[model samples]
Target: MRTLIVTEFISLDGVIDSPGGGSHPRAGWTFKDVPFVEEAYEIKGREQLEAGAMLIGRVSYDEFAPVWPSMDDFAEYNEMPKYVVSSTLSNPEWHNTHVLRSLDDVAKLKQGDGAPILVHGSATLAQGLAAAGLVDRYHLLVFPILLGDGKRLFGSGDPHTRLDLVECEAYSNGVIKQVFDVVR
Candidate 1:
């Protein structure tokens, strides 16, 4: 079975919205408060190297499609197969992109063979995957600052899910990398 990994740059208060610049008031918080530490982002490089495919929600696709393709830093992701979950998205212009309609489809994809499907910014999709128990693992870079109001990585009323810590590291810049496997 292919592993489904959800990765995010999250604030200490659990906010996962707009770590990169967007319309959110606290948008670009990741870059604003945290000093750039090349070593702190090593997990991102590792994720790109390990991921065989990318799975994301429509919103994230909309946010990333126009930018990621041209970014040299995301070349691996640009070339890899990407699956976007959305009923409304009929056509995807991103290279090697496919549309999956529902979480049921996501579950089916998880049954296929591959290195792993890495999920980037897809808060709603991640929540659904967690609630449905489709997510296999999580790679979180927890930033030290707190953004009191914003969409969070985990939502309320979700089914109880257990996680086992696989790895963790604290950086000098106060960013922490944590890898957790969803315990089944």
Candidate 2:
């Protein structure tokens, strides 16, 4: 069976909406200074190379499909199969991209034998997966900042999902990377 790993770069105050620039005022907060340590790059590279495919939501796919294909750095990410979960999206323009109709399809995908499926910057999808007990693990890179007002990683009504810390690393720039396994 393959693991579905949901990853995000969240703020101290729990905001994970836009680590990259977006509509939020603190959208580009993560880029204020380089927070990545050398080891961070190594870890990310390994994750990218080893993952069999990426599973993203419609919003993330809309954002990434336009850029990743043109970047040489994301070659590995682009080459791997991409699965976008959406009800509205019918035709995906990006090469090697597939559409998953619903979260139920994702649940089925988790039962298949393959490399781990990676989910990045898909807040809505992550929330649904977490609520449905479909996520196997969470890879969170928490930056030292407080975005007091923004869409948070966990919504107020979201059901509690307990996680077991599997790994943690603090970078020189105060960025903390933590990997947690969903307590099933």
Candidate 3:
């Protein structure tokens, strides 16, 4: 069986929405308060190198598909087999993109052979996967600032899930890389 890993750049208060630019009042929070630390983002590069495929929600797919294809920084992601969980998305224009309708489909994908499937910027999807006990790991870069109101990475009503810390590092920019293995 393959592992399913959910990765996010989350805030101190657990907010994961709009780390990049968006319509939110505090959108683009990742770059605003924190100074750029190349070392802080090394995990991202490693994730691309290690991931066999990429999985994301419809919202993230929509946000990424439009621009990631043209970004050299995301070249690996652009070329990888990408799965978007969405019932409404009939056509995906991105290269090697596939649509999976539900979390059951995600579970089936996890049973297939390959390197771990990496999930990025999919808060709702991640929550669902976590609640369903489908997520096997979490790679979180916790920023030091707090945005009290926003969509968070973990939901309130989700069933309790235990995690064992696999690795952790605090960057000079105050962004901490926390890698956790979801306890089965």
lDDT per model, in order? 0.94, 0.84, 0.92
Tens-place lDDT digits, model 1, residues 52-136? 9999989999999999999999999999999999999987999999999999999999999988999989789999999999989
Per-model RMSD to reference: 0.7, 1.5, 0.7
lDDT of 3 by residue, 97-167 (tens): 99999999999999999998999987899899988899899999999998999888899998888899999
Alpha-carbon runs more than 4 Å astray in model 3: none
Model 3 vs. true fold: TM: 0.98
Q: Better model by lDDT, 1 or 2?
A: 1
lDDT of 2 by residue, 1-184 (tens): 8998887888888888877766788677778644556665455677898899999988888888998899998899998889999999988999999999998998888889999999988778888887888888888888888879987778777788788999999888888889999887
lDDT of 3 at 100: 99
TM-scores for every candidate against the unseen true structure = 0.98, 0.93, 0.98
Q: What local lDDT does model 1 show for residue 64?
A: 97
- Ranking, lDDT, top scorer first: 1, 3, 2
